[model samples]
Target: MDTIIQPVARPSKRGSYRRHSDEFKRAVVAQSLLPDASVSRIARQHNLNANQVFAWRKLFGEGQQESGNNVCTLLPVTVVASVMAQPVAEQAPACGGIIELTVGKARLRLEGAVDTAVLHLVLQRLLP
Candidate 1:
């Protein structure tokens, strides 16, 4: 007896990007969160042509700080000023700026003159 083989699947095309209101996203995500829910079926019921329901579900779940063993904390960050290096200057001037990061009751403040390279590196590592 001969067995039939399934063809390989190619990468699916991503549809156009469109912004949806927070209420709409929340509603869709809420429906998708139900037990035994199907994202495709939900999207179809909503009449959305894009394949962004899964993305929306993830986006709405951004507040979740747990991932099995590790606990990821979401911090609040505020940059009062931004500094950039001068390509021509041998030494960059001390651009004093306040960078405040707050998570719950914890707060981190970087005041006074801060190094541009260091600040850039710190932000790169900290932010998503």
Candidate 2:
């Protein structure tokens, strides 16, 4: 019996493609978060992309205070106060007048004519 052998696939072609060390990732994240340090500049200096540094920072940030002392207890009250402070928008004044229709020299006018039938006919003519 004859057996066939297949070649093993090689790793990525991007030159060894080593992941940055934890310490290096931390340093990059720290520098990117500094008061004046821009993420794009920091990423350029570290040979990385802006998105990569941002992802690391987000992954390592605090979710909530470990002490658990109600950090957001006032959120509901603050939201309610903001909603109550706004004034309602004023409505537009109604214009009540006779409707007029003129086709070539002919003219038709009606006061307070019911619109349902006319609207239906107009819509049916306009649509397929």
Q: Best TM-score goes to which candidate?
A: 2
Q: Global lDDT of each model?
A: 0.69, 0.60
- Which residue pairs show backbone clashes in model 1? none
9-123 per-residue lDDT for model 1 (tens digits): 9989998877778888878877777779887889998887436877876775734423333555566455655556567457555556566775445556788777768878976
List the candidates' TM-scores in order: 0.35, 0.37
lDDT of 1 at 85: 54
Model 2: per-residue Cα lDDT over 17-56, one tens digit each = 6688877877777777777889999989878889988888
On the 0 to 100 scale, the lDDT of residue 44 in model 2 is 91
Counted clashes in each candidate structure:
0, 0
**lDDT of residue 24 for candidate 1:** 89
Clashing residue pairs in candidate 2 (N, C-alpha, C atoms within 3 angstroms): none
